[model samples]
Target: MEFGLWEKYYIEILDDFGFSREGDEESAKLLDEILSTEGCLTLNDLGEIVGFSDKYIVFGAGPSIKEHISMLKENYDLKDYVLVAADGATTAMIEQKIVPDIVATDLDGNIDDILLANLRGANIVIHAHGDNIERIASLTSFFNNVLGTTQAQPIGTLYNFGGFTDGDRAIFLAVALGASEITLAGMDFGDIVTKYSRPNISNALEEADDFKKKKLRYAEKFTNWVAENENVEIINLKE
Candidate 1:
């Protein structure tokens, strides 16, 4: 995505949600400050891992995921597809013994489970932003394989592949890696709040539900943009 479009979306997010962009920049700076002993994983490296499968299943932390997990397990064979989970959904998937091939997170949800998944050989794509810079420093070294990301700008090791939240970013990642087909599960953009959402993680956001819903709306918009612009086929499992 072009920097101009990124700037456009940044302003849109701010206007729509009534938040400051300063935090996002601060988070990126913090991520830059926190050095990792392990070398950075480039987009080429991620592409190599993702290019193995043309089909992909991206799991969001929406409550509907709980409803579909049994059906997905019994009816759908996931062996032919690459499985990706957004942050908190990692724990939900792991609880059912389904380990994702990639976990896209801002470290706002459950870091321990994501770390466990990393230990279990799942690729971790950690997003750096203002709210969770401290979390990044505390957990970055524990994972053997990690890809850095930032919403502000790509500085040094941190890259911007586009998309704001983890769910939408997961879709952007699939597109970036050249997946031919991308299927979504638990990506509900409704008013119902899921337990995995960061609103439950922190009390800093005063209007949590409004904030979460707005983010979800933007996520849907961003992912839809990826679908419209790219050749990739995206299907909502709920549909």
Candidate 2:
């Protein structure tokens, strides 16, 4: 996507959440710091992996994940498709001994689980954004095979395949890398919070406020946009 178009949408997203654009700048600086310390992989490397797996199953950290945990645990010949886990979903997949092929995260979820997945050889698509600067610093050192991403403008080596949240970003990444079919799992955009959500996030949700609801609204919007925009078939398993 063009940076101009991306900028327009990004600004709208910030407006929707009532956040400042300066936060993204702070996050990008932290990503620069991380690049100075650890070597980074380009989308080209990510593309090579996606080329082999034409089909994908994207897992999101939502209540439906717990509801369908049994089916996911069954395996059912999932090796044939690429497994993409969105942020916090890594922990749930790891606990099941199912390491995803790709983990699209912004380091806001479980940093330890993400680091562990990276150590285990999963391609980590580390997203840099305003809210995750400190978290990125804490976790970037532990990753070996890492790809850099940004929601803002792409600079130097960092690229933007396009999507706002990790869940939609996973779909966008797959679409960018040439997936013919993508299936969604655990991506419930509803009112209830998932049991596996980050403690801080869960606590916020306990209030039953619109904050969490609005975030899910953006997530749903981004994913829906990807489904409509991409040429591939995106099946929402939740439905």
Candidate 3:
């Protein structure tokens, strides 16, 4: 998607969530300065990978990720599709012995699992936002095949494809990069939170706080819009 078009939705996201655009910009600058894009995967490279498959499967860090993965294992050849894990969902995929083709994270998930995926050749897309500046600074060095992105305004090596949370962003990326057909697995937008929701890889399932639910609502709504508006064929496994 073009930045000109994406900015309109981004403005609304800032207004609805009351997020600070300046803070996001600051984080973006820091990330851009630190990330060495030399010899790394470019947007073109990503396109080749995403477009390699007939379908793209984007997985969210919802509670049902394991079951959905199992269903895929039982009925289909995963090698035929490009698999994307959003943030903490990387843990679920890794646990299932499935290494995602790509991972979109904001340093807010299980860093351990994401790193493992990176080591296993998953292209890592790191997003810069206000809340994760410190986390980004501390952990940026641990990743390989890194690409930077910012929702506010992309600078230098960073680029913005669109969408809010990691899950929706992964879909946006798949569409923008090359995938024409997509599938969403374990993308439940309920009011439940679990160990798989965020960085707490050692915890149990729990109720989502109001703020987390609010964000999920945005992700769900935006994802639905993409399915309807974008030219790609998006099949929501939940439906």
Ranking by TM-score: 3, 2, 1
Q: Write the per-residue lDDT of candidate 2 for residues 125-203, one digit (tens) a residue.
A: 8888888887777777778778888887777667788788788888888887888898888888887665455546545
User: Judged by lDDT, which candidate is best?
Assistant: 3
Candidate models: Cα lDDT each: 0.81, 0.79, 0.86
- Residue 24 shift from truth in candidate 2, angstroms: 0.5
CA lDDT for candidate 1 = 0.81
TM-score, cand. 1 = 0.90
The alpha-carbon lDDT assigned to residue 9 of candidate 1 equals 87
Query: Worst lDDT window (10 residues) for model 3?
Result: 33-42
Q: Stretches of candidate 2 above 4 Å error?
A: 73-75, 201-208
Encode model 1's per-residue lDDT on 59-162: one tens digit a residue: 99886887767778988898888899999889889889998999999888787788888888799998987778688878777776678888876777787878
TM-score of each candidate structure, all chains considered together? 0.90, 0.91, 0.94
